[model samples]
Every structure is written in structure tokens, then in C-alpha cells.
Target chain A: MPKGPGEKRQWQFLERMLLIRRFEETVVKMATDGHFRGHYHLYIGQEGTGVPAIAALKRKDFLATTHRNHGHILARGADPGAGLAEILGRATGLNGGRGGTIHLCEPKLGFLSTSGVVGGCISLAVGGGYACAQRRDGSVTMALFGDGALEEGVSYEALNIAALWHLPVIFMCENNSAGAMGMAKGGYPSLVHASKNLLLIPKSMGIKSVRVDGVDAAAVHAATTRAISLCRSGRGPVFIEAMTPRWAGSDPLWPELATGITDLRMATGGAVPTGKHQAWFEHYDPVLRLARELANGGEESVHRLSALDEATRKRIADAADFALASPLPAPETALNHVFVQEASA
Target chain B: MSKQSYAAALVDALHDAMRSDPRVSIIGGYVLGLGPQRTLTDRLKQDFPDRVFDPPTSEAGNAAVGVGASMAGMRPFVDLGTASFSYLAWSQLTNEAAVAHYMTNGRLTAPVTFHMLHGVRGGGAAQHSQSPHAMLWNAPGLEIVAPSTAADAYGLIRTALASPNPTMLVSHAKLLGIETEVSEKKSAIPFGVADIKRRGRDVTVVATSLMVPYCLTAAEALAKDGIEVELVDPRTLVPLDEKTIIESVSRTGRLVVVDECPLRGGIASEIAATVAERGFKHLKAPIVRVTRPDTPVPFSLPLENFVTPDPEKIAAAVRGALKAG
Candidate 1:
């Protein structure tokens, strides 16, 4: 059943997706400007996966994502401003500036945690599922990972255990078709074929599996609703393969080369905007699609977006200011939190 | 109070903890009688069937699950069968459970107890027999406990389970059958406290885990030779009882550390460094360490005996320290 056409929910989703996209773009600029430290994996083109997957979850449901987790964090209701502060290494960040982008967490929003290591959070979500099942709690655990993490052995192990124990977990695989520059050609024969293989692995292990058009938010929400229902009825450990594409060009060279090809404007070539090249981007600019839908509905939708955009921008600005003004962790604290110290004297 | 073996005492401690707290749970392979060494999990399952879980054979997954359960406010005792098997779950123990409290800035607490049977067990061979005390002890966030007696076993394991942070109890397989008089009532033993099993004035013998009893036996033989030996058991390796070891060495004027791990970068080396730094003025001689050679433990009985630290080696180390003093 469609969640009533509430402008509030639509605006909320649009604002979050836009915030994530803009924040990531800003961070990329910051990286270029030498203001940001460490390598950042941007979720620019894949905002659809997070928007839809998280829109289907309740406030009590928990989420654990991989290193490419900014979109997921924002989708699960973390303030984009705090997330930006974290990436900026500010104290106002979700992890108190201790964990940068790679380890962002907002437990208050049921964002359990994120791990830098690929496929590391799979078993953690399974554990969370077990906890939920043991307590007979209706809360579900969504473990989000990229297509690259499928190569890890622990992922398979976690699926097997989750299936055997009948835990309440939703394993959502966002197949971005590349594992940090290794394209599908060099990695797998095809993204969909590989996803089919993954789906089979989980199904054979007794988990219910599904494949959805991840670009379509409604499709993702429907699939998630079904998965959540099955889980609540004590029939889960479900796997969903969301066939999606990288929004930005996978490598910097590809975009540069594409621009050069268009610049040549040969006789056979036609003038098209740089944005319309990728079919995935054209059909699934998640934020744009939601905004267009909301505008078509009525003037109230536009009003909601305008108000939300202002509020979100202000929140992000405030967080950035707070983080920039905060102090860096002390040198001695570098080793702190690696382990829990004894209770203070 | 009845006499109890080290393994039995551990089982009793688990039972007592389960009876006292409803949140305590167990998960691991053969942890519920799927394997031969069914003593630990068998007793647990028999007494507390609901809490003692027979997890699938995925050490990494189970360990991570234990960390999750612990973070969710459950006291989970994860049995990894052997310390060497812990390498598979090293990421979970090191990155997740150990750091969760600090990473979340004290908002998260992982009260998970990792129980492993470490050290050489008969002819278990390379993969199964290796001691990983030094490996775990090096990790900052984890509380590493290695008890050498039934009393300390019950006390330390109970205390670790009660702790709000991640703790690991590495029990030696060889010490499983060693019987000792243990009280029926369970009690908590404070971490970082050393137990003086035997007292003397000539030299201080600092030992850990299975080597503690061997040190005491060696001390008896040294006393027969009119060489007074003091034996110290550092029940917890991470928050080491450096004060007790230093005080004992200060009184005895000599120090000898016996460890089952290899000589290079072992706990013995750390203890020796501690003595050199704190008790250097009181030391009548250089601090000596009796430990296995820097090599993989051999399968042959005589070769294993030669490589592992035993009573003979402890006695010889004491004589050498006395001579040097």
C-alpha cells in the first residue's frame, strides 16, 4: 500500500538526498582544495539506493553500512550537517569527530555503525538480527554494502548464519558495477549476472532473495516493505540486489575523455548535455525525480521543499561552523578508544 | 568445598554467572557437544540450555555476533575453541569490541567474554597448539586474562564476565585436568593483581598462566638447595600486576620471568623491561626470562619439552639469577 501522499515525507526524502549529494560534491571540492584529509569515496550518482531503502524503514529499524556510507547515513536520518562535520573532522560530527567519514554513526537514529573494511558489517547486522529475534522485537536490521563487498568470504558466512538462525535482516547490495576503479569488464562478466549469482547463493542458504530496479524509489520501497513483513512474521534473512550504476564516472579519466569526445563534435555526433550521457543518471537523478514529482502534485510540495532546503542548509552550515571551531583530538588520544580504559579513579 | 579441575572450575564460573545474570549467553562451535572436548559447553548447555547457544562454524561471524549482542546489552561468552582460531575473528575482537566503547565516546559498552583454550595440548600440532597471549596482550582495548589455578580461573573468569568492557580469558589445555581445592561460592578477582604462590628472599619468579604451577614446583626444588625463590602469578596480562612483581624483586634482589610464549617479544620480555625500568636499583642481577625458543612448538615429546618452559628450565633460571646476583 502506498504511504499516503504526504508532502512532508516527500520533502524529507528530497532534502536528505540533495544534502548528501551536495555535501559529497562539496567534500570533493574540499579534497581538491586540500582542506579535507584522507581518501573519500563519493556517493554522488547512487542517491536513489539510500533514499528508497531508508524511506521504507521505521524509526526503530537499525542500519549498518560499508565505507561508501554517506548516502546510507543521511537516508537513515542522520543530520547531513553532522555528517559533513565528521568528514571535516569536527567534534560536532556524529562520532564526536573521532571517527571520520569511514566510521560515522548516529545511534540515536538507529544508525548502529559503519566500517571502513569492506563487507565487515555484514555479520554485525546478522548479530543485530539475532538480538532482535532473541528479544522477539519487530525492529529489522538493514545491512547495506556495495557490489565489491560480495567478494569477501565473511559475507557468505554471514548469509549462511543469518539464514540458519532465521534472523530479521535485510541484506541490500547496491551494485555500482565497480570496486574502486576496477570496472565490470575487469572484475565480473556483467553486474546483473553477478547479482543473479549472489541472489542464488543466499537463496541456496535458505534466505529469501529479490532483485529490484534500484533506480525506482517506489520499487525499492515495495521490496523493502515485503522484506520487512517477512521478517516480522519470523520468515527472514532476505537478500535484495538493487541493480544500479555509478552516478559519477567511475574514473576521473573517463569523464575527461568523454568530455573530449563531445568537444570534438564530429559529423556523427549530436549536441547533448554532459549530464544526459549515463542512462542510469538520466532516469534516476533521485533528488530531481522526487522534486519534479512533488512539484507536479501541487504548490504545497514546492513550499515544503523550499522550507526543508533552507532548514537543511542552515543545519549543515551550523554543523560545519561548530566542527571547524572545535579542537583536534589530543595526541595522546590517538590511542584512546582503541580499547576501553578502566573506570576512572 | 569440593576439589575441582581447572576446566570444571571454569564451567562452574559460567554456571554461577548465568544463574546470577539472565543476560549471559554463549556461542561457538562444538560449544554444545558437537566436538570431543565437550566439557566447557556441555556443562553450560545442560545447566542453562536457553542461554548456551550452539552457533554455526563461523568464528568471524560468531565473534562479531557476540560483539553485537554485547553492544545490545547482552553478556555473551564467545568460545573460539582455541586461541589460534581467534585469528579468524581478529578483526571483530580488535576493531569492533575493543574499540566500540572509545569509538562511541563511552556511549557503547561491549561486555563480551572471549574464552579460548590456548597453549600446546598434547600433539594438537602447529595450527591448534600455538600460544597467542602476546598477540592479544598487545591489543590496547582488550583485557587479557591468563589464570594458572582453579581458584584464579574461577575468580578471573567471573570478574571478566562482570566487567563492562571486552575481556578475553585464555586457558591452557594442559591445565584443564589439573585439580585444586576451590570454594563453592563464586567471587570476583580484581584485574592487575598478582598472587604470590610461594614466598622466599633470594629471587622473584614471575610467571603467567600454565607456567605459574611449574614455577612453584621449581621453587620447591630451589628451596631444597637452600635457594629461597618467590613465585608471582600475574593473573591478568594486559593490566599486569607490575607493582607486585617489582615489590617482590625489590625484596628478593633478583627477577626471573617464565612464559610459555616464544622468547622474542613475549610477555616475559615486557616483565623484564618493567623490572629494568622500575626495580633496576633494587636488582642484585640482570632480569632473566625463561621462555620457549623463538620457534613454532614442535610435535615430538622431547622436542616439545625442550622448546616449552618447564619446571627444569625455571629451576635453572632461578639458579642462574641467584648466581648473577
Candidate 2:
């Protein structure tokens, strides 16, 4: 099954990517089936950025994410059952049912916060950087946000502070709009901003900034590795803008599986790309692209990938069942965590 | 016991907290704003240079830094300068810091103490003169401490620093010079405990922050006119000592809530509502509120005074409540 020297790393990346993909798909299915309420953003096409970027972080490094945070959390190795339970407001959820979809975070896993406020995580991560600086333990903080977050006033303030303080933070902006949005039809665009280039926003503060292809996992991993090393050396607060085309499902105000469920076989010879989503399958889909890369090792590699996909599907299915079976938080326990209680004698 | 100025007690509290815990750190420029208090903070900075930070004047961003630092095991003391300027940080303080513990369902804690100088101070105009504690009280999961004495300031600031929840330490510029006997042996006072500044039986005067001093003067004046006033200073707003206030009202059968906020939807309104809701039978007369008028504090001295509550206003409110029923 292992053809190349780095085949293990390749399979690991593919497995994490598949986990995020199927977890988000299950989220959509559960939402459609009336298991949860409220609007939720999907991290479908941007898996390449989150998986690779997070993989580069050390165990001590802190991370803060935005509304499109499900992929980032899963990439950090959070339990899917707990994540889905949190979305369902169950007592066994990650946050004990308090922080649902948008705020699904695990502080134990070095997550500072998952802010529902557009650019809120950016500023919070700066504080995390300050904490790392105080500890002087070689830890860094990463702020994972979308292009729309750059339009917020707090972003400028946070970026300027990070630069002045030389705080160890990596500002990763995932630009899924890909410059094709705001056209005559077919797509929704990022919020309008005067800056022609989002990178300039951080560059203006004298911050070291770079741009990368969001669909290329290797490129993102390289950029994040370099950024983390720089931050750990105290020459930090780097900015990376990863560009990806908006997923067709993310076009409407609410997320819809416009491409249907991703067909991994389309990467192998068994299936063929067709219809309006042909361009997405060919280039933009990070999961399929990685699958196709692994399948390039011939028939044995394809069989291994197929088995991996089936196991991943089963795991997500079990997570969905666990979330569905988990009980909702007790009505009287709403006031439990409002204030931190002192331990009893 | 030694005489300590309100400002000195506050500075000492911060020093004690930093010395007691390695994780306690201070953030902001000129903690108490530009004044003699700056000298005290300058000393603090010299003592703990590594623990103190003077960030740019991004109120919301700085407050968020405190929230973020707290989440990372640092107990941050963030100063928002003036209560008016705190409006800029309302979102960070209310949305992020205050909600961190509750939203995370005990998985996280933001033990941040936000300090601000609130209330009217002479000719400080509309933007400079504001008491936003009432508005802040509306947001759940935040501990609001408004100490009325040098001793209370020394005691409450320590408790605020030690709290596991986000806390707001509301101070007053006008009360800085006021001196009271503060014992060095006193420990951190627990929250949700009310202090009776003066004992009387005719009316219960509930005051906060600078209003406590004004109400003290009013109580003295009323005592001379054959009326006794019992004064209750609720140290913390979020975990309010309703029992103390209600018991005082039960004895006096009259309540006069004096606060520096606007009359409409102010701290006085909330206290009055609480009394009416739970202590209705104890109140023999309708409750009266002595507060700043619902208007932008004018720049002119007389116009500002006309809207601000003072000793005369508190005394008048007590007399009015006494005669109401």
C-alpha cells in the first residue's frame, strides 16, 4: 500500500481531509433532517488550508478560528462525536452544549476561542501571542480567519499591535472568494473593502506577509511551517493569505451541497467529471485533488484509499448516531456555568 | 489603622495582587488616566516591568487582549481609562470576556479585571462624564464592583483580581482624594456583601461609588432635621446583596436609590425594581431614585450640576419618600 517514502504522511493528510469533508457533510445532513437549528457555515473547499496549516502547529501552539471553524477544529484532532454533540446542544458536547456550531472549540487542545464575531478571533489570538511571549516557552498563536475578517476595524488594531509587540502569531487569511466573486451572477463576494489586496492590510503595518494557493496542501504546509519557525524565534506576527474559489454550495446565503456529496471515485478511473461542477472537481476540490495524488501510485494505492474512505464514512456515521443519542442539557442547568463556583470543602 | 486616600488604596490593591500572584499582570497606558495616579502606576511599572504592558489606545482591542491573556492562564488587569471610553470596549468586554465562561460551559475562564473611572467630575463634558455601570449591569456573567471607601477600594480590588469570572472595577475621579481609615490587616472582602456606612431608622439610602459620599452628607443633614437615614453601599452589582438592602428597607420602610447614571434605565431603576419585586411589603412608601437627569452632561458647570445628583438631591429624595405615604 505504501509506494513512496512519504506515503505515510500523504495518507495521514488524506485521512484528515476526508474526516473534515465527511464531518461537514454529516452536519449538513443533520441540519436538513431537523436535528439542529440556526445557520452554519461549511468548510468544504478550504480543507487544504486548515488541515495543512494546523498540521504544522506544535502541541503547545495556540489557535483561534472564525465562523467557518468546523474544519479547523477537526484538523486539530477534536472528537467528531463531541463536535456534533455541541452542534446539537447535547450535554456531552465539547462545551457542554453552551458553544454550538460557530463556537465549537476545545481549549484543552490549545484552542483559545472560536469567535462568531467576524474579526474577533484575530484580536483574541494577539492576546494569546502575548501570553506565549510572557511564558517565553517557544509557543506561538495562529489566527485562522476568512478574507471578510480583514474588513473589520479590530483586524487593523490587532495587526498593528502584533507588529509593535513582536508577538508570536500567524495571521492566516483563507480567501475563498478567489477574485471570481462579485460577477454578473453565480457567486457571492467577500465584503467590499478599499484595499485592493488583502495582504497590504498586514504589510502596511510592516508585517511579513505571503500569499499561497489554498488548494495546494503542500504549499500551505510549507508556508505555515516557515511562519511558525519565525514566530518561535520571536521575529513573528506573519500573515498568509491562501486563495480558494468559493464552493458552489457556499454561494447561497445558507450552505447547500450543490456539488452533491464529493465522489472520490471521480479521482480514480472509475468515475468521470461532468456538468457545471466540472471545473471544481478538476482543480478546486482539495479532497479529490489529494485523493488523485495518492491514487497516482496505481491499483494497490487506489484500493488502500477506497478502504480508508469506507472506514472514514463509518466513523462519521457512528459520530452522527452518538450525537443523536446524546441527551440535551438539562433545562435547570442553564445557570451552572454563569459564574465559576468555588470548590466545596 | 491609618488614613489612606481612595486612590492610594486602589494602587496598593493592584500592587498587592501582582505580588501575591505571578500570573497577575497590568495592561493599558496610565492606568487611572493622566493625573497623580499616573505616578503610582509608573512605580508599579518600574517594580514589575515584565508584567506590565502599555498598549496603543485601542480600547476594544486592549480589552480583548486582557480576555485572551486570561484564557491563557494570565490574570490581566485592563484599564479602559474613562467610563465613556469603555463604550468603545463594550463589545469586547460584554460579548467576549463576559461570555467566555458561560459560552464555553466551564471549559474556559476569562479572569480579567477591567478598571474604569466612572461618574461626573466637574467640567468634564458629555463624552468625558458618564456612568455606564447601569448599562454594564444588564449584561449577565460580569461582576461589577463599585467601592465607596478607601477600605472598600483596597478590599474589593483584591477580590476582583482573585475572581474567576470577568470583573469590572468601577471607580470615580471625584472620590480619589477622599481619605478614610484603612487597616493593613484587613483581607480581601468577599463580593455580594453590603456595608452599612451609616445607621439610622427613618429611611434607607442605597448609594454606589461617588454617590455614597454624597448620600453620607445627605444623611447627616437629614439627621439634623429630626430624620434618621440608614445608608447601604452595595459593593458589587452583579451579585447584589439584596438581603441587606431589603432588610434595611424593612426597618426604615423607605428606599432612596442614588446613582450617578441617568434616571431612565439606570442602576437606581434596577435596585428599585428589585426592591419592588422581592421586598414589596417591606416598603411602606413608594421608592424614590436620585439620579442624573436623562440628558447629555452639558459642558457648562451649572448645566452639569442641574443634571447631576448631589447631597441636596439625596436629602430631598429621602424627605420626599418619607412624606409619600
Candidate 3:
């Protein structure tokens, strides 16, 4: 470990960014391998948005996110293997594999909940922040959503309440210009104006706003640290917009050919990098940016990335193995977990 | 024991639950409604200023907020106002809160209590009145409990607050004014347990929500003839105490599901289907369902009355089931 505080923190950012990158990679692979029995939305290009935002928070702070949450969970210290195992529907997975990709919740790690509904968790963070405000627990909540969520009235409802009450919530929107495939097969260009002008909506509601370059992890961390400071000082209910792009470029179709997937990879087999979007992801990746930044420190940073990459890959592999070996849930226990007592039963 | 209306009981339950747990939050079109209902969250807001809130008339947003708070460790008793209006917030209530626990592999629990006023009251036609529990019940991860009495409301509301499952506590709007004497001591109504409001041998009349009281009335009328009526109230719908219902059906050898929702695939159908599937051999006649017509709740009072499953209609359905037997 590096001795200087700044150096140590910088390395932490690099490690987290890499882990997020790899976790998404493994998830794309798992989806390819048919490990996910349900629908999954990949978080490939959005690592820079979530990793640093979560890094700025304390463990007690709550993170309520949208469906694209793999990056958010990984950034919040969820074991990648466990996360993989979870998506694989194994009992040992993060949500016992029940949440799959879209509805994952790891409350112990302060990852409150994720919803497939676009604007689902925006107002939810407001409620969580309300609890934090009443308790004076010094815990703030972050609502991480994509550009499409802004179109939904829930975001406005959430911001209005958060602002009205001065709740300790940081409304974080990662504008990826993405929409549901059910609605838009390609990216939603109509959402561009909304994404660009999103900061104004929160501002009109009386919540303070800050804009940041989400492509750079350190910049995101610095922005979030400032936001967190403002929140802790009782100047909260802040809105931060990270204008970032998805690494899979414009169309983030799955890698699976049979499932309308394109420009993605399988879990076990490495992708040869065919599509233009894949090449772009390889070239302008945020994790790569952070790694390259860390590598600026010369041999030490180089050696660390080398070791971390190998360890993370092994961790993901072990997770896949564990998930593969884990038993499917018992048919009789289907009634189990309908209620909490039933879970015990 | 003191006499209290169902609405007052709900208000009292809200007060009691909020007092007991600091995490209880109430939000939505949830006005404490009538003067009596106002006593619930109004006082709650005064005491826990930050916890009790009335967000913009946005049910989808409000639903998300409640679920989020519950997920983050708060027991949100959300008054979605009318059950019919829940259609506006269906995506969150159904796709989010309802499916959260099961989808999360049971690691996450949404303990939010959705207090929705259900059934067709005169003038509440169409959007203003609907019993969506049958629709909501189709979802796997939620508990839908409709209480017909003041005691049932108090007990079930308390249970919903204490419960870790996402619960829809549908209190019949018509039952709001109906008063009953209830013990001041807290009533703890466990989910999935059927209450045998009235027991008889010839036929079983399983009713829900306000229909319970009506069925009791019909049971009285049916007693004039040789037909004896057994009445059961499955207070909590999702954790349906099917065992109790099946047993009652086996003894009676006849079953009729009385509900206020639409006839097509509502609670009545679910109950009838459950009994038909599990207790087939016990049936002496085809399982009958006396529910509101598939048509939307009509605006005219006469049309509404004609469509609603009243005591007369229930008696007719029972007689029809008896004739079939």
C-alpha cells in the first residue's frame, strides 16, 4: 500500500474502477453463457459514473439505483463473485441470485435497492434521505439514474420533495442517452436535450446543482467529495449530473446472436473485439483512463495494475465456478421468502 | 371496549404503529381523508415532521419513494387513497414493490404498507372505484389483505406495519363508516389466516372486505330455507390460508367466492380456482363466484347497485349453487 493519503486514495480509485469494469465484463459473459434466466441490462460503459460517487460516501450512506446497477454495486464494495453468483441464480449470490441484474439489493453494504423501472429509485432516495434527516444519523442518500429517468414524472416528484424538505440526498444522474430496447432499439437521440438541460430541473426545485466530467474517475470522486461535504454540512438535497457515455458506444445490444444481442462478449470465452463499438469501448474506456492515469506513477503503478487485474479475473472466475456449482433453489421452498418468517422456514 | 369506525381504526393503527416505530412514514394522496381519517397522518406529521409527507399528486413517484424508504429501513404506511387510482402507479406497485422480494432472491424485503380504499361506492364510478386486489394478487411478491371490520382493519394494519412483506391493506370504502366495538388492546392479525366469521354445514360462503358483512346478512336469509350457510373471511389474500378454506369447503361440500372486484379473474375467481384445483373431490357443485360484473363500475347509482354483489345477488348465487348441488 502507498503511504501518502492522496496516493493510497488514487490507487483505491483505480482498483475500484477496474473491478467495476471487470464485473460488467463478467456479467456480459454470464448473460452470453445463459446463466441469467431473466432479462439483464448491462452497466458496461457507465462505471465512471457510479464508482467515484459511491467512493465519496460512508458505509452507512444509502444508494438507491436504477436497473443498470452492476457498476453501482461493484463500486460500493459488493463482492464481484457474489454478484456474479447472484445473477447466476445461486443461493450464495448477493441477493441469493433472486434479484438477478435489475432488482438487486444488498442493504448491508448500503446498496438499498435497484428497479427495472427507469425513474423507480429517484423518489425512493428522497424517502431514505428523509429517514436520515429525521434520525440525524449523518448518513446521506444517492439516487443514481440514467437520462431516460428524467422523462418520467417521478424524478420531478423526487427532486421537489427532496428540495422542499432539504433532505440529505444527492440526486446523481448519469446521462448515458440510453432508453429501453422495448421502446428504442438504438440510443434515444430525443433524450439529448433533456439530458443536457437536466441540471436546470433540480435547480428550479431549489436543490443546488453541480456538473462533472464522468469519464474521469478522479474528477467524479472530487466532485462527489465536494457534494458529500455540502450534504454533511446540512447544505444537502444536492443534484449532480455526470454527462458520461456508455462504453459500448451507442447501441448496447447483447453479445448473444440468438437473443437480438450484438457488440458484446460471453462470460467464459474472450471476445475478439469485432464491432466498432467494442473497439471504441476498448479505446476510450473510463477504467482504462483511470488505469492509464495510475500508470503515470511508473513501475509501482504498473506492477499494482498487473497484480490487481490477475486477482480480479481470478475472483470473477471463482465466483462463476461457485455459481455454476451452487444448487438451484428447492421447489418446496418456493413459498419460502414470500414473508420474512417464511424465509426462516 | 370502545366502538370505532373502520376509518378511525385505520387512523388509530397508523398512530400506534408510528408511535411504536420511528421508521413508519406515510405519504401520497393520503390526506388523513375524512375528519376521522385526518387524525392519522396529520398528528403523525406534527410529531415526526420529516417522516410524514404529501408529495406532488404523483402515485408512481410516491410508490417509488415508499418502497425506497422501506428498502432503506423505514416502515412506510402509504395511503394510495383509492384502489382504482393505483392504475397510475401500477409499474412501481406491481413491477417494483410487488416483485422486489422474490426477484431479489428474498434478500431484500419491502415492508411498505399500501393502504388503498377499495370497492365500488355509489358515484365513485370507473376510475374512482375499483378493487384491483385480484389484479395485484396475480403478482408473486406482495401480500394483499382487505379488512371488512374495524377490528380487522386495526389488527391487519398493525400486522402490515410489523410485517416484512410488501402488503396491500385494502380497507373497503363502504366499511369506513361502519362501526364496531373493538378492544383498545392492539389486535395482531396474522397474514394468510382465514377467520370463520360464521360457521354452518350445508354450504360455505367465503367473502372478502365489505362483502363479509353482506354475506353474513345473506347467511341469515338463507337460514330460512333448509340451506345452512358457512361464512369465511380470508382477511389476507396473498398469504391465503388455503388450508382453512379447503377444510371449510370439504365440510360444506359447496363453495361460493363473494368479492367486489370484477367477475373476470378477480379474488372470487382466484378463490374459486384454488378450491376447484385443490379441493375438487370435496365439491358437491361447481364452485360459484358472486362478484361485480366485468364491466367498469358504472356512474349511475342504479347501474352501480345493479352491478355490485349485494346480499340479494349473493343469496341468489348461493341458491343457484345449492340447486346445482
Candidate 4:
């Protein structure tokens, strides 16, 4: 049975992508339901950039992302329940509840960390890459950020250092046109932010750069594979501008934060909110489009993909349950883990 | 033990650390020629080419990457040029690196030693002159250390390299050239332990960094006046050796703090407060602090000298603490 519409491996890839979508969908619900608190940036629409691009990375390879990090975490194989538990500030979470949505990390799994600040994780990626080069770990570090990060001077510094050292890093920019703040109500055509092309900037720095349609998971995987190969062979520190679109249409949480709870129902209960941009998101939606492609492989491929979505949905439900049931960190342990907390056994 | 300049001691430690562990390295704007026309790091750079890094000019980026390297199992001595430049990387330093271990629940630890030269070095005024030890002292996760002697600079830096937590060492620019006998052999100077340089019963003078030597000088001059001043150097500020300071105060029943940092919210203030809280009953007089005024360091030598706490100021504070109450 073929996994995705194209390659047999792609179906599993699609499953991972859909699972991330399911996870993000669940996160929005949980965040709204009061299971999670504090400022949260959902990795909803930009799943294409995180999943396939991060999926290409192995266990030893480090993956760093921005505040919108769930997709990157899960695509790197972070347990859905544990991630949710962390977001819910549970003692059993990845960061033992100290790190909420913005700072999820599982170093053992090569997902070093996520930074709330824009372009913050870039230097970490460079540093990780530098360490890997020193150790000759035969591993790579990929830094994923948005077009918004390009505006940050530190991002350029990170890129320049990466290029100067030829560090084994893939600078992946998920170009959602505008960030969570500058979401064009229409689409990229209507996006007003005068964002510079990420490719041209890196190219000017003599860094090997590439661009690919991020919505196509297979395309993303193919491009990332080439980039990683270059990094592995030592002619590296590549820049990849994946034209990834965010289906969020508009800032979901801000409106809820502004209008109170009345606007929550539009996105809840799996209701597809009405709008031209929403329709565009639906048509261009990676999952739906991938399913449409899988439909070419007859009903069986489509069924398998749907089954993946359903199983992932169920898995996300269990994650929510785990998040809700897990205990908040003990009050007495507030000062714990400031330094590497040694094993108590 | 051979006498070493503060510069030589730092280089000796860096060489020892890099030689001892392959993971030990230095990252900064320029490690070579860090002081005067020549530097200890410049020598280390020639020796361990890969370990010593001259990164592009970006304090925030350099700090982030340095911390990242630390997390990736390297003991990186990240020097952010002058102490004032730390202001540029304040966000990353305080928020990201300092809080990393606590925030990540100890799954990740950055053993990065951030080095910055503080205090007013003559013409090095305003932007160049800033004693940020006070700033780093208040940050909980970051262990703060300021070495007045060449031995401690060598010993403490090595200790910081070995530490699992983030550490910031603020070396006074003036102390770098001062020659002093270090350990005969390699030694690790543990943090949170005060070194009692001179013992006297008249009054206990607590000091830090450059002020330690100034306090010692003050003690000598005051001793001529038949005023015996016991001086204490709380080498590390964060894991402050409050016990030693308190015990010293308990013995003397009087306290005066000499600090190169500002008067308000400086290490002296903290020391004064600590002695007051823990050893108030032991006090025979009010705590006095000889510190720079809470203002930007001026460029002119006269103005700078006036603001900076010197032997005269330290001696005056001792007399004040003894005479009052």
C-alpha cells in the first residue's frame, strides 16, 4: 500500500504531516479551553515547512524552531502527549512544566529547543552546527524561522557566521508572507508587508540558497534532502526559502483576546470558518491537496490517509487527556532544575 | 609559585583548560590582543587555532551561539568585549542562557563562562567603562565572580569552565597588569568562599574585584593612624560568602564595604544589607560603602577619579563606619 500519492515513504510523511495538523488543531482547542495559558503561537498553517523539512533530519541532527514550534517538535517525533503535557505545564512534560509552548525541547531526540524571540534560535543552530563540526558527529542542525525573522539583524548575523564558518546548518525560512501579526486577510497576492526575498540575501553572502513550494510535502522533502546532503558533504551552511503559506487566514488568538470568547466557536468543533481566504486555505491546504493527490492512487490510498487523520485525531484526544490529567509541577520544586538536576536515584 | 600578571594568569588558565579538555574553547569578537598591544588569548589562539574563535561583530548572536555551543557539550569562554557591550546582549544573556537550565528542567545545561572587563580604566569612560558585576550579581542562575588577584583569575576561570551552570567573570581592567604569585601548581578556587586577605579587629571591610585591593591599601594607610581594618574579599558575588562576611562582622562589630560598582544597588549595597540582616546585633556602627556615584563614568581623568572609589575613599569610609553610632 502506497503511503502518500507518490512514493511509499511519502504516505508515512503525509501521515506525520497530518498528525501535526491534528496536534495543532487540538492545541488551539486546549489553549482556548483553559488547559494551557500564557502567550502561545500555534504552528498550524506552516505545517508543510516543519514536517517534511524536519522529517528529513535524523535523530542526531538538531532541529530548532521559532515560537510556532509544535509542528517542528512533532515532525521531529516528539510525543504528542508529552508535548501537550509540557504546554499544559505538567511535571511529566518534556521540560517538566517549566517550559511551556514557546520553549519545548527534547535534546535526546535532536530537537534542542524553541525560542520565543524571533531569530533567537538561529545562533543556537549555528552553535549546534559548530559543535557537531568539532565532534565530527556526522550530524546537521536545521534552523527554521519565518520571513519576520529576516527583518531581525541577529538573523543576518547568524547567517553570516554560518556561512563564514561553513557550519553544517540548513537555514530554513518558512515564508508565510506575513507573520502571525501581519496576516493578509486575502492571500500572498494581497500581503502588504514589504518583505525582502530570503534567497537573495543569503545568495549575496555567498551561501548556497534554494527555494521550493512548501505546501507540497514531497517537494519540501526533496529540497531538504539535497540541502542536508550538501551540509553532510561539508560544502554547507545552505539557505532554503520554502514558500510555505499559513492557512490561519488571520490572527485567531488576538481576535479572541480582543473580542473575548465569542469568536472562539468559529474555529472550534472542526467548523470551517467562512471567508475567501478560508476557501483559498482549503484549496491550498497541504493535507487536503495531498489527499486529492492520493485520490489518484484510487480509493484505498485516500482511505489510508483519512485513517491516518482519524488515528492522529484520536491520538491528539489522548494527548489532551494526558495534558489535563498530568500534575502541575510541585510548589516545593519551584527552585529545582536551575542547573542540570542530577538523577536522584 | 611564579609571579604572573593578571593577563598571564588568564592565559595560563585558558591554555590549561583547552589542553585538559578538547571541548574547552573561547568565542568572542577578538580574543587575540584583548589587552594592551598583546594578550594571553592571542598566544592561546596560535596554540589552539580551532578552540579560539574570532566571531563576527554581534553580541546578541555571539552570546546565543556561545550558549548553544555550551549546551552542545563545550565549555566556552564567551567574552563580549568590554563590560558595557553586555548591555547589547542583555536579553539573550539574562533571558535565554541564564534561565536555560531552570526553564528546560536541566535537560540542557550551558557551561559557558562569559568574560567582561569592568571598572573605569582611566580614559575608558562612558561606553567603555561599566562595572556590570552588579547587574550579573542579581541574576539568579548566573554565578558571578570578580577576581582581584592574578591567582583567583586563573583559578576561578578554570572553576567556571568546570561548572555546569552559566558563570560570568568580570575582571577589572586595572588588575590585569598587576603581578601576583598564583598557585604553585594548578588549583581550582571554589566559589562562595571569601578570602580574608588581612585580619584586624578594629573594623571589617568587605570588598570585591578592584575594590579588594583598594580596601587593602586603605587598611595599610588606616593602620598608620592606629586603625586596624580587617579586609574580606567575597570572590564570587552571586553565591556570596555571606557566612564569612557575617562572621567577620561578628568579630569586628563594624562593617564597611568598598565596591568599584555604583553606590546604589551595587555589590556594596547587597553586602551591607546581608551583614545587617544576618549580623545586625554584632554591629557596633552603621555599615558604610565606599563606591562610585550612581552615574555614567565620565571621560575626563579628574572626573573619573573623583567618582571612582580609591584608597582615600575606602579609608574615609572605614573612619566613618568606626565613628558613627
Best by lDDT: 2
TM-score of each: 0.91, 0.97, 0.88, 0.92
Candidate 3, DockQ score (0 to 1): 0.42
Candidate 3 wrongly placed segments (more than 4 Å): A1-3, A26-45, A178-196, A248-252, A255-284, A298-335, A343-345, B28-50, B184-186, B224-227
Candidate 2 TM-score, C-alpha based: 0.97
TM-score of 4: 0.92
If both were scored by DockQ, which would come out higher, candidate 3 or candidate 4? Answer: 4
lDDT of 2 by residue, A1-345 (tens): 356646777688889999999999999999999999998999999999999999999899899998889999999999999999999999999988988999999999899867899879999999899889988999999999988888788878889889999999999999887644453464555657787798888888999999999999889999999999999999998999999888888887677898998889988878999999999998999999989998988998899889999999999999999999999998998877778863200
Ranked candidates, highest DockQ first:
2, 1, 4, 3
For residues A1-345, write the lDDT of model 1, one tens digit per residue. 233775566666667777776666556655666665776676665676778788888877777787778888877777776787787776567777777878887777765546676767787788777767766669788888877677776777788888888889999988776433444444222234345466787878878999887766667778988998898788997899887655544444222122121111111122333554544323555555565566665555556556666675676666566656766655665555554554410
Please report, in order, the local distance difference test score of every candidate based on alpha carbons.
0.75, 0.89, 0.76, 0.78
Given candidate 1, what's the lDDT at residue B64?
82
**How would the candidate models be sorted by lDDT, starting from the highest?**
2, 4, 3, 1
Residue A166 lDDT in candidate 4: 88
For every model in order, the fraction of real contacts preserved is 0.44, 0.62, 0.62, 0.65
Interface RMSD value for candidate 2, one decimal?
Answer: 2.6
Which ranges of candidate 2 are over 4 A from the true structure?
A1-5, A179-189, A342-345
Candidate 1 lDDT, B76-182, residue by residue in tens: 89998777788998888888877777766555677889988888776766787778878777777889999998889999988888888889888888888788777
Supply DockQ values for each candidate: 0.52, 0.57, 0.42, 0.50
Q: Write the per-residue lDDT of candidate 2 for residues B130-176, one digit (tens) a residue.
A: 99889988898799999989999989999999998889999998888
Output the worst ten-in-a-row residue range by lDDT, candidate 1 chain A.
A259-268
